[model samples]
Target: MKILLIGEYSRLHNSLKEGLMALGHEVTIVGCGDKFKQFPVDFSIYARICNDNKIANFLFKSIRKVIGFNLEKIEKAIRFYLLLSKLNHYQHVQLINSDALETYPILSRFLYKKLFQNIQSRSLLVCGDETPIIDYLFKKEFKYSVLTPYFEDNSIEKEFQFPLKYRNKNYRKTFNWLVKNCQNLITSDLDYEIPMQKMGFQTTFIPNPINTDKITFQNIGITDKIVIFLGINRLSYSKKGIIYFEKALEIIREKYADKIEIIVSENLPYSEYISTYNRAHILLDQVFAYDQGYNALEAMAKGKVVFTGAETEFLNQYQLQADDVCINAKPNENEIAKKLSFLIEDPEKINKISKNARKFIEKEHAYKIIAEKYFTSWN
Candidate 1:
């Protein structure tokens, strides 16, 4: 099969490509390296002209803010339009999210319609930051969702922009066009699967693919000074409940300054970010997800106990116990601190969870296994 993956989020498509290739399929990935995180891709649409010229970038941004129209978006739309001829006629094309083209509504609609007509088979990957899923999440009013912080305090303008844009007439129309036109909708985790199903879209839920060969498991030994790593992206701080994690980290540091070591990397490139936390005993990932994202899954594959959203739904889906495989983090500061404290005090428990974490990834999210699933689904 000749497959074309249209976008990327935290190297999800790259991993999937590796899996597909290993299964003897030709796969090509085109993306913008997901902005500064810089995940690799076969074809890159990442534009540096405006961004490299600080003056032009500033002017473009200021103009957008003052006039409610982004010139940069228009430029991206033109670029994508020119790339359309190159993107057509694949056996399969999977958009990473609804906003895969990264353009304004008019251009997005045009590009999506063209791509849908050109491709042999079209599919949608319900990964993070998708407009439809986010809109649905806001509508359902989940008790603790990515939009909770924005709802709790409307002052979060940046975080609130997603819901605002998704609710707009133009964005909604474009989203509906793609949703109706796509042949199959797939979700890598329960976070998206549940909401998509609620919205009356039949979605296939597949566990995220982790390149197990690349992430070799290391047997974590019990050590007196336990290191905990927390990587933060300022843009997603509120949505991922990082404020709560920060509060908990402060408490943990104050209480066990001598026994615990906290390592924090802020917005590092993907390659550097992953390597930065390799020595840590635990990884603090997102708090609002029902299942782990790529980073958490990658960390878990490396035999590190990751504190993420392994809720009851995720546990039952995998038929595994929560505390044993991964730590289910809540939005509450006290509960997060308590969970961190428990692991800090017990080295044996960390080792046990680390082993279970690696095993879980091998069984459920290994790249080959996940790629096979995709092959079957696409066929």
Candidate 2:
């Protein structure tokens, strides 16, 4: 099968493409140029411009790093422009990732309608995320599929992740498009399926695929000090739980004070990221949720016991208990301290969890398995 995946998130397609290729399917991904350096995909489609203007992109992204915006429409508009530039530069096969859905409504209707018609005839469009655009373009005549992120059974993070506001000038139009055109909706979290299903859209469940091979999991024992990694994108601190993690660090240092080491991986060079983890024992994944973000997953692959409060599908897939694979702790100081104290007090537990963490990933979350799922979905 010849598959085309459109999205800016490199990790998303990197794993999916690897999985699809392993299953003997040919895959091509269209995304930003930056993705090419870290991940090599079959084909590359570069989105030339930044949204909100290049200056706005820089300022907004920079400001968003410290604090995110509360304006929904503005946020959605920015995303739309980013994606429009993506489509404008897109020159390849037709399947679309819903990364641009929020912005599609406001897009030049004439161009969108033309593109929709072109895609309808040229390729089987797959919606990777849930957005109104997916619904609008879904038609009986057009072949399409949706695959999304999935959370665990009991997810507190979902409350924060899903947007609730529904006022939009073009929403009804998009909704009507979806009802009339889409064939299926797939979700990483099955919980999201209900809403789509209620809309009478076909639904399926596919967990987020991680490219395990990229993560070099190693077992280099403790050096003189232990490292606790705190890495979040240059995005907002609230959603990523940086503030909570930082506070937890304050408590940890006071309690241990020169006893344990705390290393924060900021916007460092790639070489530094690898070496930093090698020097540390635990990498703090995230605060507000479970499903270790890419940072934690990468750390886990490197044989480090990651500290994350999330327990999403990926965690459950490994059959790992809270303490076995990672040090699951709340954002609160006391809770983080308790979890930290246990690992610090017992060197053996760190070694055990570290070892198990690597083994669990190999057994359950290997790229081989992940690729299979991607292939199955695409083919």
Candidate 3:
């Protein structure tokens, strides 16, 4: 079958493309390299003039003020329009998310409608905090989610524009468009799956595909000091519960300053981000997720002990205990600090989880195996 995978996030679709190709299926991907992370794609419409050209930025702002639309997005929609013919006539077409093309709602509906006209099968992947997922998160269904900060204190409205914008009526119409047109809605993680289930959608749950062949496991060797790494994206600090990690790191620094080395980097490009954490024995990942995000999963694949969302829902799904494969970092700063101290005091635990982490990825998320699952589901 010829498959057209739309959009890229943390190289999820890229890895899926590789797996499908290996399984003797032709696959093509069209996306912007997911901004700074710069994941590769076949057709690249992700370039922008507004960022580099003052005139373009001025026009975009002027247009947005008058017409309630970004001029840059209009240009992107045109660029995507030119590629629709090439993207058509596929046996299967899957969007990485609802906003795969990254255009405004109305523009996206026009483009997506054209692309889907000749496609045999249409599907949507719920991989991030988009309209449907945010609708679920808004109800305070989970104990704590990425929106916990806003739920507790609504002062930080500026940081939440991306997720909050999906609540607009126009965005809701586009999402409903996809829901009505697509044959199936698929989830790539437990975070998405649980909420999707609660929303009463019979969506298929497929674990995010990780290319184990490319990511070789590195055994943790704690010689003198345990290196702990924390990466931050300034835009998502509160949403990802990264602020909690920052607070926890302070406690760990104050107490176990002699036994460990802490490295913190912010807003790194994809390649740089991965390299920055390579030397670490422990990685502090997101706090508000029931399952690991792409960065945490990649770290685990490389045999680095990761502190991410491995909640009881995740544990029961995998039949594992707390801190078994990866440490489940809650919203509490003290809890995170205590976990770090335990790892520093007992370095053997790091190595044990590191090995187990690699095994878990290979067993559950291998790209080829996951690709076959996609193929079977699509059939």
**Which candidate leads the pack in TM-score?**
3
Instruction: Pull out the clashing pairs in model 1.
Output: none
By lDDT rank, best first, the candidates go: 3, 1, 2
Full-model lDDT, candidate 3: 0.89
TM-score result, candidate 3: 0.96
List clash counts for every candidate, in order: 0, 20, 0
* Candidate 2 local lDDT, 162-273, one digit each (tens): 2211224454454445434434344443223333555565656555565667677676477566677776554334445566678878887987876687777675544455
Q: Clashing residue pairs in candidate 3, if any?
A: none
Q: Candidate 2, 172: how far from true, in Å? A: 7.9
Position 280, candidate 2: lDDT: 77
Model 1 weakest lDDT span, ten residues long: 43-52
How much does each candidate deviate from the true structure in C-alpha RMSD?
1.6, 8.9, 1.5
Better of 2 and 3 by lDDT: 3
* Candidate 3 residue lDDT tens string, 184-230: 89898999999889988889999988899999999788889999999
Write model 1 residue lDDT over 1-379, tens digit each, in one string: 8899987768999999999999999999877787779989887777665566898889877887898887766776677777778877688888887778677888888877777677868888888766667768778556678887777888877766755677778877877777788777889998888888877778888889999998899888755689999999977888899888899999999999999889998989999998899889989998988889889999999999998998888888888876878899999989999999998887889999999999899999999999999888877
The CA lDDT at 202 in model 2 is: 67
